[model samples]
Target: MGERYEYVPHRLLRRRVRDIASGVEGELMAVISENVSGVGAEHWVELAYVRGPSGREFTTSVGNIESAPGGEAG
Candidate 1:
């Protein structure tokens, strides 16, 4: 497959950014740059689905990362 997705959120770990999504959690292989904003902010992102429960198939999204945007999401 020639298609590739970027890990805007995960890559920002340098900015002290760590995100967790539903049905998925923990470290991922690597985060790449899908789209970078002129404002130095990430609009869209793709995660490698580092950790997940056994027998569970789920995809990661920026929405999940935005929900908390850091941690302790209500």
Candidate 2:
């Protein structure tokens, strides 16, 4: 049998996220880039590109997002 997959809403990519480990709370930033379905149907995965306060770029999965405030779609 083939693996089942579901479509992720584009609105999810627009939401901002912050790293709880950074120790600074209540801060959010938009994802500059993403591959919504890089893993394909077999393994559903969503990746987002974000820039930290330090000006460092990193990738984080949608599931990892601590918070998602609905905003403009990227």
Give the number of the best model, judged by TM-score. 2
Report the C-alpha lDDT of model 1 over 1-74, residue by residue, as the tens digit.
22344444453232222245353444343445455344654554554433333533334554454222443322
Error of 1 at 14 (Å): 12
RMSD of each: 9.3, 7.5
Minimal lDDT window, size 10, model 1: 65-74
Q: lDDT per residue, candidate 2, 6-31, as tens digits? A: 33454444345554444322223343
Model 1 TM: 0.28
TM-score of each predicted structure versus truth? 0.28, 0.38
Best by lDDT: 2
Please identify model 1 stretches exceeding 4 Å from their true place.
1-24, 32-45, 55-58, 66-74
